[model samples]
Target: MASCSNSNELLSELVCSVCLELFQDAATLECGHSFCKSCLDRKWDSEKNSICPKCRALISERKYMRNNVLSNMADRAREMQIKGETNEKTQIKPSDLSQRAEVGNTDHFCKEHSEKLKLFCKEDETPICYTCVDSLKHCGHNFIPLHDAVSIYKEKLTEAKFPLETHLNEIEELQEKQMQRISEVNDQTKAMELHIKSEFATLHAFLQNKEQQLIQKLREEKERTLKEMEENLRCIKEFSDTIQTQMHDIQSWLEQNDALHILQNITAIENLLTRSQKNFIKSSPKLVKHGITLGVYKGPLQYGIWKEMLSVINPGLTSITFDPNTAHPNLELCEDFTRVKNSGIYQRPLTDSPEQFSLCACVLGLEAFTTGRHYWEVEVGQNNSVWDVGVTQASSNRRGNIQISPKNGYWTVSLRQGILYTASDSACEALSAKPQKMGVYLDYEGGQVSFYDAGDMVHLYTFTCEFNEKLHPYFYPGLKGSAPLKLFHLCL
Candidate 1:
C-alpha cells in the first residue's frame, strides 16, 4: 500500500510547474532539466538573463527545438496520466488501491493452468509455469528458477549497458569531428580552386609576354632581310642604266664613223657587261619565308598545365592493389588486382592466411599509410545494390560479422538499397545523393578522410580520426550480387 502511494506520487514530476499540466512540445535544458517549450520561451521573454526555471543556470537562448528523447518520455507520461484519470473517473476508492497492490503479487501466474510461473526456460528465453516446464514444449530444455534467471540476466544486462554512456559520449565526439572535417574540406577545396585560377592567370600573363617577344624578334629579322634586298635593288638599277648607255654609244660608232671605231670600243663594252653579269650572279638573293613554329608548345599546352598542377595537388594518386593475403576466399581480384568482385566459389586458397576475411567479402590495399595525404577513385559501377568503400586499420577484425564503423576500425560510406550511408556507432546517417564512382581523400597527419563524387566535388561524407596503427584502403564487394569495384590509377 505504501509503495502504491509512492508510485502515484512520482507521476506528478512530469508536469510543467508553470502550467501545472502535462508538457506540450517538451524540450530539455542543458542542466538535466526539462520544461514545456512554450513555457520556457515565455519565461525567458519576460526575464532579461533567461535562467533555468528550476535551477538558476543561464539558459543560452529562448528559441529551442523539441528534444526527441524528452518528447518520447512526454508521450509515455501523457498516456500514464490519461490512464490514471480514467481510473479516478471510474470511482475507485482508497481500498481499491490496496487490492490493486495485492493483485500484482499473483501477476506471474500462468493464465491457462493458473499455476505459478516459477521456472524460466533457457531455450525459449521465457518464464514458464512449473507444470508447463514439464509439458511438451520444455520437456527436456534447460530451466532455471525465475528468481535465479532474473538475477543472472539482470547482471548481464547491467554489464552490457555499463559502457553505453561512454560509448554515447564517444559517438557524439566523433560526429562533431566528422562535421568539422566536412566543413574544413569544403573550405579547403574552394580555396584551392581559387588558387588554381590565380596561378593559371599568372602563367597566361607570362606566356602572353613570351608570345609578344617572339613576334617582335621575328619582325626585326624580317625588316633586316628586306633592307638588304632594297640596297641590292638600288645598285642593280644603276648598273642597268650604264649598260643601256654603253649599248647606245656602240650603235652610234657603228653608224657614224667606221668599222675601226666600233672595233676599238667593243673590248671596253664587253668588259663592262661581263663585270655587270658577274656582280649580279655573285649577289643574287633567293626568296624564303620565316616565322615562329609553335606546334609542340601549342599542342601540349593543356597537358603541360595538368602536369604542373599535379605538384600542387599532392599525392593525388598512388596505384592501389589488393593485398592478396587479406582477400576473402569468396572474393576474386582482377585487372592486376585493382578490381575486386565476389566469386560464387567459396573454397579457400591452398596457401591460406589468417589475414583473410572469414565472413565479409572484403579486401585491403597492398599499400598502407601511416602518414601523408592520398587521393584515389573507385569505379563503383551500377552492378551491385550494396557496397562499402573506405579505409580500415591493418589490425581490424576480419573473422566476424562486426559493425563496420569508425569506432570499430573502419571509416567507410556505404550504399544499400539505393541509399548512401556514412557509418556511425548506432546507425548510419543517410546522404543526400548517391554516387556511381566515389573519390576518397585521406590526410594522415590531419586525421581526415573524406568521400566525394568522383565526377565532381559533391562531398558525401567525411570522418576525422587519429590513428595509432597503419591504415589500408578497404573495400567490401557485395557478397550476393558480386559487382566489381575497380580502383582508378589516375586522379579525377
Candidate 2:
C-alpha cells in the first residue's frame, strides 16, 4: 500500500491535474492549480461549467484571464535552456520580471557620414545623422526627428502604395486590351493605305489627262492670238507704205506744177487721193468680237447647263451716264480714254437713282477686239462690307454689243439714254429717263465723275476693255446718241 501511495503521488505530480498534459500554454487557475489554456477551454466546453477541473471550485469565465506571469516564466525557462544556461530559478513569473528578452535584432546605419542616421532633412528629402546636420552645408536646412519622419513616411507609403497597386493591376488588364487595339488599328491603317494608294493612282491618271487637254487648248489659243497679231502688224505696215507713197507723189507734183500736164495730173491725183482714203477706211480691220457661254464642266466637252448662268469670273467693265449740270466741271475726258478729275473732288450723281452708286463696268464691243477672252478685276469697299471685284463675259452678244457683268455685287453697266436689247433675241428698249448708273464705272481720267462710299472718297475699279477703238472711254453713257457724247476714261 505504501508503494502504491508513492506511485500515485508521482503520477499526480507528473501530469497537470487540470490539463492532464506536460504543461503547455500553462496557466494557473484561481484554485491554486495550473492547466493549459487549451485544455481548460476544452474542459469548460465539454462540461458547460467554469469550475476548476482539478479542485471542482466554482469559477466564472471572468476568472479565466490569461496567466501572462506564468507564460513569461515558462518563456524564460525555455530561452535559458536554448542558451545552455538552464536553471530552476530562471523560471520567474512575468509579473516579477523587470526586463524582456531582445527580439529580432537587426542593424541600420547611415550610408553617408558612416554614423547612425538619427534625423531627416526636410529640404534634401533624406535621412541624416548628427554630424551631417551640424555640417556647414546643412546648417540652414530644415530637419525633423527620424522617428517622426518615419511615421509620416509610413502614412505616405501607404497612400503611395494604394495608387501603385491599382495602377499595376490596371496596367496588366490594359496591356491585353492595348494589344487588341493595336492589332485593330494596324489592320485599319493597312486598308486605308491601300485605299489611298488606289485613289492616288486614279488622281494621277485624271491629272495626266487634264494636263494633255490643257496643253492642246493653250496651243490653239496661242496660234490664234499669234495669227491675229501678225495680221495687225501686216495691216499697219501696208498703211504706212501707202501714206509714204501718197506724200512722195504730192511733193513731186508740187515741184512740177509748171508742166502743161500738171493740171490734168493734179485733178487725177486728187481723185486718186480721195479713192485711196476711202479704200483705207473701208479696208481697216473690223473690230474682233468675243463672248462667253457659261456652262458647268461634267466631262470633256460635256457641260451641265445652269438655266441662269451667272458670270463670276471677271466683270469690271462699266458704263455710266453723266449730267453736265450735276457733273463736276473739272472732270474732263482725256484723249487716251481716261477721266481726269481732281483727286479729292466729288462729282454729281451719274444716275438719279437715290444719288447712291456702286461701279459696274462691261465691255460694250468685245467682238470688235482681236482678243478672244477678256479678263478684269476690281477692288472696292473700305470697311467690313468690302469685297474683291471680278468681271467676265456671261455670254456672247450677236447684236454688236458685249454683255458684261459683275461677280462680287450688283452693278449696273447700261447705256445712258441708249437702247439695249433684253437678250440676244430681244428687241431694244430706249432709256427714256436716266437709268441707275448702269453698266459704267467712274471715269477718273476725264475728271468728269467720281465714285464714292457715303464718306465720298475715290473708290476706283480696275478693268480691261478690248476693242478696235484705241481711245476707248472708261465710262460710257448708259444711252447712245446719234451725235458724239462725252464720256469718262477708266484709270486702270
Model 2, which residues run further than 4 Å from truth?
1-205, 264-267, 279-283, 286-492
TM-score of 1: 0.38
What local lDDT does model 2 show for residue 87?
Answer: 37
What are the Cα lDDT values of the candidates?
0.60, 0.37
> What would the TM-scores of all predictions be?
0.38, 0.22
Model 2, 360: alpha-carbon shift in Å?
Answer: 16
Residues 1-492 of candidate 1: C-alpha lDDT, one tens digit per residue: 665545444444455556655567787777667788889978888898877675456767654556776666657767765677435433223233333333344345554334456777777766677567646667779987766765554344344333433433443454454444444444544443343344345456545554455345444644554454444444444444444454454344334332222222444544544543453355432222212121211122222344445543343455678888888888877758888888867645734455788777788888888987676778888667788889999888888676788888999988778778777733344545567787777768767787766655455666777887899999987865566888854322
Ten-residue stretch with the least lDDT total in model 2:
295-304
Candidate 2 per-residue lDDT, tens place, 17-83, comes to 4433345677776766677788888888888678766446778662765666666655554565467
Query: What TM-score quantifies how close candidate 2 is to the native fold?
Result: 0.22
How many pairs of residues collide in each model?
0, 50
